[model samples]
Target: MNKKVILSTVLFLSACGGSDSGDGISLNKVKSNDKAKCSNSRLDSCYYDINQLALNIMFRKNDTGVLNVTASVSGPKQDIYFTGSDVLEIHADGEVFLPTNNGADSLRYENIPDNAQIYEFFWYRNSQLVEYNSIDGITEPSVILSTSQHDGSNTITTDWLNNPDYTYQIHTPSLWCTNLNYESEMFSPSTGILDNQRPPYQATLQALYGKNIESLKVNYRSCDISVTLIAKNNQVNYRNKQKRLFIHHDNFSEHPLTLFESN
Candidate 1:
């Protein structure tokens, strides 16, 4: 037989699955294309820009003292999870985004056990892990509220945690109040002050009470701020070195307004 003919036969056989390299694309390569796994930090940084996130979480206590958590987030690239578990049961709620697409997500979990002081949550896409972290559990005297402004008026209202949670209000005018772009606990009941005021506004308000609970006023300021609560408290504390109105309690009757003033 001619050498060319032998070469042609070998080529034909190889095309017909006779080659040693195996026929068709290797199945292993295709199978290896499965989704990539990620650590909590890795996944979080991948989908969410930690620098531009606004996360608000509120926990309300039931009659039994077990707290229920509701979280709202803005500017997240994917879905997230608020998870907590004890030996007996798990408190897990998925699909927390309020609108469920591109917008913010609001998730609620009922009867969160009090055993864990901090709760962890996660962000995921296509069954792949993204971001996760632990949050402080809501104890007694917890203050949670949402702050927004319109036409030079800032409205501070109670989030889910406001059923006799605390007595206060943001009475200051000409202020820019926000969550300070934080993902952790805002008001610490032990200190009795609005400890965490999301940045761009550094004024912290103190809830003052004499008999019927008088006013929520700014006790700390980083700059020249001339503002007052609407109903009461005409004086402002600046460099007064006051402890910033510290209060801690197991129960209360009033939900005071929290104001964020900026100048």
Candidate 2:
């Protein structure tokens, strides 16, 4: 195997709905030659570059009552739980670039701005940005909306440790799921407004709310960014030398599911 320094300058980004050259990242970067497992096995390509990455962006409130925003990234390279790296960063909305600290096997950031309209994740080495492979997706909020568990047991049996498993909503402009309200219970969330604008906020508005959302002047502390654009954030490597720079991008957030299902 004659490996040479190629200084590959191509960048790759794919998310939610998978992509081919026609709709998403360029197909030239996706030469499926390596048979090794990718960080995201769901993707169909191997022998790729931008080795193992799993990023989970969550918007929740910490104990101090401030919104806690975190992007947890791991390098599941080869079979190990981490990848070799030095730095990580985020591109918030337009040209704003935010740097984050990296641990041995993971990348993380917090204190994200409430007004940040959209965000893109990236990995860096030696101060320059590098592409990532197989983003393991965000943890989209799940609510037990409308269930039969309350047929007389889970809801009425009061001597409980957690909140009653009942049908309620935590509403964003588009998402009616969890509440920003916190009852004086142990790690339980009340049903009310969404605390932050998450990636799914806008889609919730269009799917269930009216078509005149922009005209309605609805305000949220968080911004609902499209998952499709979550992968829309890609960057080029600046280094002039490299041993192996294969190419691939994986954003697995587009798994199909019913927003609401009735029992």
lDDT of 1 by residue, 1-263 (tens): 10111112221122232212222211111111122432344223223333344454454454456655555544344554322110011223311222112222455444445555434343333332222334343435433333333122222233434333233333232322232342222232112233222212223333221111112223322111122211111121121111211111123223333333435
The TM-scores of all predictions, comma-separated, are 0.28, 0.29
> What does candidate 1 score on TM?
0.28
The 0-to-1 C-alpha lDDT of every candidate, in the order given, reads 0.30, 0.31
Best by lDDT: 2
TM-score of 2: 0.29
- Model 1 regions lying over 4 Å from their true place: 1-53, 62-64, 76-105, 142-263
Candidate 2's error at 100, in angstroms? Answer: 5.4
lDDT of 2 by residue, 54-116 (tens): 444444433243434444443434332222333344443343333343332222345444345
The C-alpha stretches of model 2 lying farther than 4 A from their native spots are 1-51, 61-65, 75-86, 93-100, 104-106, 125-154, 157-263
